[model samples]
Target: MKTAYEILDVSEQASDNEIKQAYLQKVKQYPPDHHHNLFQQIHGAYQTIKDQKSRLNYELFDYPEADFNILLDQALVSSEALTLSADSFDKLLRASIDDSIFQFSTTHKINNT
Candidate 1:
């Protein structure tokens, strides 16, 4: 479940040249003929950061931890206990847990490098 940045082995704030260099290095190691899956992932990651516009759009939508917390808190508060059955409540809880895990992973990835 690595982010594109992780796939490229580049920092979130990597410069264009740095990203290009990393992509090239990765391609050299995992050429498409022999490593099609890995090569595709590397290429996709490169495309994501290949231009300023695409990079800006990606960054703009990458939600912060606080935003996700706020959203989850709102969901809990907005839920009507009387309207949801036990099973529904369980499902909601599971979704909340999943969201939290996703948030944690994103945060971890950002902080790891």
Candidate 2:
């Protein structure tokens, strides 16, 4: 899935005006009358991160789609020369899960406040 920034062809650091300009260009390239689906996507992306607050909200909540097979392959290749005991691997996985949960809770609390 393309991120709003990607769809708009704008950098993540783009200002509101820059994003608006990019959106206008995209609309011109894919006008609703001739390219309904592309126009809808562009419009949706624009709505998603058109302003500072909206961009922050989207960044806080948007989770990228992960390719598990690719991740697994990378992990296996990286660990090929080293062997992890069952207990060590289990500990590593548990630690990663714990870190992710902690981060989520922290972000949730900050957003709620």
Candidate 3:
């Protein structure tokens, strides 16, 4: 699935004017009269990230389309080649817990101080 940015062929950091220009170019290339579905897709993509607020909202809420079967297939394929020793897994868990505790303590100190 193409993101709005991908559909419009613009970078995430593109300015509003740049986004608008890209949208205009897309519309010209796929006008509604001649290419209804493509035009709708372009128009919808434009509406999603046309401006700063809309872009922010889209980023916050938009979930990419996913195929669960493909994801499961990939996960199953990868799992066969990857194995974790018990000791390594234990160390990883301990490290993650320690890091979380450190971060919490630091944040708490900063908030209180």
Which regions of candidate 2 are displaced past 4 Å?
63-113
What is candidate 2's lDDT per residue for 1-113, written digit by digit as tens?
A: 78888999987767779999999999999999999999999999999878654554465456344333443343444455277777876554444344676578879999999
Task: Write out the backbone clash pairs for model 1.
Answer: none
Clashing residue pairs in candidate 3 (N, C-alpha, C atoms within 3 angstroms): none
The list of candidate 1 runs beyond 4 A from truth reads 62-113
Q: What TM-score quantifies how close candidate 1 is to the native fold? A: 0.53
Q: Model 1, residue 1: what's the lDDT? A: 70
Comparing candidate 1 with candidate 2, which one achieves the higher lDDT?
2
The lDDT of model 2 is 0.71
Candidates ranked by TM-score: 2, 3, 1
Candidate No. with top TM-score? 2
lDDT of 2 at 10: 86
TM-score of candidate 3 versus the correct structure, residues matched by position: 0.55
lDDT of 1 by residue, 4-99 (tens): 778888776566789899999999999999999889989988886675445543443552312344344435556775587889866775554446
2 or 3, greater by lDDT: 2
Models ranked on lDDT = 2, 3, 1
The C-alpha TM-scores of every prediction are 0.53, 0.56, 0.55
Each prediction's Cα RMSD?
13.4, 12.2, 13.2
